[model samples]
Target: MEWIIGIGVCAVLVVIFTIVTYNKLVSLKNRFQNAFAQIDVQLTRRYDLIPNLVETAKAYMTHERETLEAVIAARNQASSGLRKAAADPGNPEAMKALAVAEQGLGGMLGRFMALSESYPQLQASENMKQLSEELSSTENRVAFARQAYNDAVMTYNVKREQFPANIVASQFRFTAAALLEIEDQAKRQVPKVSFS
Candidate 1:
């Protein structure tokens, strides 16, 4: 009789433990999704701003048609990649594609900005100034959102890899998510400043 009671108690404890672990994994995964959603919102804002910036610069940048077109193309590709990644944030391939596309878009935008500096009319335009400021603000917000997403992914991954949780994660197929990274070395470098 005592043996039967001991067996029942052990079984109940095991079931309770499993339930708790599963719930924890679900919560962490949901947190990752929420963080990624924030990134998506910022990216969408960026996509919307790109057209206005391009249009404002077009009037003064008639000679830079190729550069403008490249920017638009890159933006379109990045937007598509973003949609795919948002559908499955944990997919390594989707994440890689998005990273690559974003890097290309960043490179194109950087080149366009550098070229814009040579055009005084474009640089001095009120519309251009306002668009530039807005873009800069959106970039900052995107950076913050990416940081938060990466932090959440790190936390969730750590939990998934930890001892008992690892067993549960494997059983439930909780894959680790890839961090959204700036793949361009140029972008990673700190800009030099001169006060003179």
Candidate 2:
């Protein structure tokens, strides 16, 4: 009789452990999803701002059609890539494509602003100034979003690998998320800013 009672208690303990572990995994997964959603919101805000900036720059820089078009194309590609990444957050290829598209957009945006230097009148224009400010603000927001997403991924991944959590994670297929990479090689090579 005592042997049967012992077996029954062990079974109940195993069930309780499994339930707790499963709930923790689910909570971590939801946190990761919430992080990705935050990034998407910032990216959408940036996409909306890009066209206004291109139009403003276009007015003073009539000869910059190629640059403007490249910006537009890159923006479209990035938007699509972001959508794809959101659907499959575990795919590294989608993340890489999104990063590349964003870099292309950044390059075109830099060219647009550099050309703006040629026309001081345009640079001084109220519309251009406002658009420039808006772009800067959006960039800051995107950086914050990336940081937030990384933080959430880090937390989730830590939970997935530790001790008993590892047993649960392996059984349920909880994979770690990829971190966002910084884009510009030129910025890393040298002091990109020149006061002269």
Best by TM-score: 1
TM-score of each predicted structure versus truth: 0.94, 0.89
* Candidate 1 local distance difference test against the native: 0.92
lDDT string for model 1 (1-196, tens) is: 9999999999999889878988998998899889999989999999899999999999999999999999999999999999999999867898789889999999999999999999999999999999899999999998999899889899989999999889989999999988898677786789999999
Candidate 1 has a TM-score of 0.94
Q: 100-139 in candidate 2: lDDT tens per residue?
A: 8888878877777787799888898898899889889888
| Clashes (candidate 1) | 0
Steric collisions counted per model: 0, 0
Clashes by residue pair, model 1: none
